[model samples]
Target: MPDTEGHPEVNEIELVDVFAALADPLRLKVVRDLLAEPDGVERHCTSFGLPVSKSTRSHHFKVLREAGLIRQVDRGNSRMATLRRADLETRFPGLLSSLS
Candidate 1:
């Protein structure tokens, strides 16, 4: 579903998957921090005092990304996460708005 600009169109992403991803307490905290962050000032992986080890933290982030709950991009040595607020709002209507 690439557009004329050669970018794959983001289709109608599922509500269940996104909600399920955020259902985890750790994942919910991750998304909440992302929502409050300013542009280019995303929360990093090391900042969260999650009880899990490094590998487990890696797994949660991966699930969040795959669920379309967050948009991730490499920033130097770490990956930055931004909550997909606008997209999720459109799909579920008032989902992030009410929660925020």
Candidate 2:
């Protein structure tokens, strides 16, 4: 399958990586915000209101994507993000709920 924004393919998803990606305060908040959205909510990066530099924000998003916590796709002139909810839920049942 084609890679989606560098996220781990569904088969490659790992619990350890997901946990590590969520360990950071900022990243955890990012995930939380995404979770708060209605299912399939595609958000622009800046809409998160994260208190980080542009480069730092990009890095955080990269970490999350690499860890399979989120999937990003190009939308028009900007990139958008959405939580990888189903993949995460299947890999570790009820884990996302526990984070809230």
Candidate 3:
């Protein structure tokens, strides 16, 4: 399976990694907020208004992306993130729904 933006393939996504990533309250909030958005909607990172420093926010995003919980891409000067809802559902059914 091909990887996109360092995201794990659906088959490679592990429940442990996802749980670890979601363990962080800030990261979990990011996931929950993304879940609240309509499917396929992407939000700029800055839109979240995370209380952490810019680098800290970036770190949080990287963790989420690497955990296969989100798909992120660079857009101009900012990064945009979208929850990997379908992939999550395919890999672990009802996972995302339970988080919402």
Give the best candidate by lDDT: 3
Instruction: Give per-model TM-scores.
Output: 0.78, 0.93, 0.93
Pairs that collide in candidate 2 are none
Off by over 4 Å in 2: 1-4
For model 3 the TM-score comes to 0.93
lDDT of each: 0.71, 0.89, 0.91
Give per-residue lDDT, candidate 2, residue 2. Answer: 28
**Over the stretch 1-100, how does candidate 2's per-residue lDDT look in tens digits?**
4275587887788888888988899999999999998978999999999998999999999999998888999988898999989988888889889988
Q: Write the per-residue lDDT of candidate 3 for residues 1-100, one digit (tens) a residue.
A: 4375687888888899999999999999999999889999999998888999999999999999988999998888778999999999999999888987
User: Which has the greatest TM-score?
Assistant: 3
lDDT, candidate 3, residue 49?
A: 80
Least accurate 10 contiguous residues by lDDT in model 3: 1-10
lDDT, candidate 2, at 100: 83
Candidate 3's C-alpha runs over 4 A off are: 1-4
RMSD of each: 4.1, 1.5, 1.4
Estimate the overall C-alpha local distance difference test score of candidate 2: 0.89
Each model's backbone clash number: 0, 0, 0
User: Which wins on lDDT, candidate 1 or candidate 3?
Assistant: 3
- The residue-level lDDT of candidate 1 at 19 comes to 80
lDDT of 1 by residue, 1-100 (tens): 4333222224646778778888899988887777677644566776767889999998898878777776666789987667766677666787776556
